[model samples]
Target: MLQDTFNLMPLWAFVAACGVTLVAGFVKGAIGFAMPLVMISGLSIFLDPLVAVAGIVLPIVMSNLLQVMRFSWAEARAALREFWRYIAVICVMILIAAQFVTMIPTQTFYLVLGVPVVILSLIQLVGVRFHISPAWRRPSEWIVGLISGTIGGLTGTWGPPTVLYLIALDTPKAKQMLVQGVVYGLGSVTLFLGHLQSGVLNGVTAPWSAALLIPAFLGMRLGFWMSDRMNPVLFRRATLVVLVVAGVNLVRRGLMG
Candidate 1:
């Protein structure tokens, strides 16, 4: 049983997992994405996939909740209204896709996730730019929400498409972060409910989830502290590079599996 296996995991493994969570958390705090992309991909190598996923879920949700709250309710409500259609599409797709998550072969799942992130990172790194105008809003948003939610449901990676869409929107930095936080927090709630229905949230995942919280919170705090000192451009570049590497590794794991 998963519980029996989890109980047998060594102390060092837990410690290492916590360390990784801290690093991933810091990156998440600094950049506002990549927490799951970095942590889950890395931790899965050492821990059970279920445990890894469970460990990161609450931290991601909590962090985003804090971020979303930073904006006034009026601002948040306005943002939600603007993106309501896309959010609705994403939520429905995520609920539908949740059922198939376990059926997906881990290798294939990783490949599907890794390839696009890597490509996107490379494009961004090269200064390739695409802008979304008012004319392109509807179709572009639908596409982004659909793809992002699908991937999020399957692999816990809903960041890339939404990030790309927001980038194209050319929003101000504060608003961009706020929107991303709100979307992620909302998506996390959907995922949590879906996992609960599927029995993915239970005793087996609970201990590790609790254990991971310390590192996750610490990492987030550290990242927040560093954010003011860090150059935005440098932080983005570093994040892109990390994403590219993690994406490649995921592809390799998928192919090997």
Candidate 2:
């Protein structure tokens, strides 16, 4: 099945996608976010958008799982308890949204995915301080979680919304990675299962998605290595800059297409 899917693509394109996945993994490892955004944006360049999405689903799940495992069980449980409400929102909404993957138009998908990413990244880059009083935090989580899940389902990218929500809460750097892993890890589990039920991850796409895991893991190791050595502030800013660029490109494609 995998051979049949790959056979449809030029050899060069497949090789290129593997490289793209590696870079995506590296970015995820360094930053603890944006893997899905990077994978979909890069792979969508050559592969059919739907196939591009399916290919990255497994990688997202694997990387996120590894992320949580980096922390101990007690830490993981604590993060989950803290963010459980938002996680619930993401899980339920993502499954609901996943059913509509093929139902939405491609142009609309791009627009929906790109616009929020650009806005969120720009907001962060500007250094706006969001003092979320305890009053509005719960409601905000639901709203953001819904948006993230819907976008995740439609375009296979949900990191931006989640990131914005966490930053707004002023979550510290280390906790941020753990929470992101827990939150996104849970979502990835749902995403994988949701897509399976929705017919998005069948015989053909399954093989392709699994195959991309090689580069994803390799790139993530390199990124994890760099994360230990690099300045967090600088690397985070770099991630935002990349997000801005990728988001703008997506917006352009949506408008042009």
Best by lDDT: 2
Q: Which pairs of residues collide in candidate 2?
A: none
lDDT of 1 by residue, 49-154 (tens): 6566666767777767866776899988888888888888787777777767667676776787778878877887767767999998999878888988887776
Q: Which candidate is the best by TM-score?
A: 2
Native-to-model Cα distance after best TM-score fit, residue 194 in candidate 2, in Å: 1.0
Candidate 1 has a TM-score of 0.92
TM-score of 2: 0.95
Off by over 4 Å in 2: none
Cα lDDT computed for each candidate against the true fold: 0.78, 0.86
lDDT tens readout by residue for model 2, 1-257: 66777675788988999999999999999989889888887777677777888898899999998888899999999998888999999899889888898786787777777888788888878887676778999999888888888888877777877877888888998999999999989999999989998888889888889989999999989989999999977987888898788888888988998
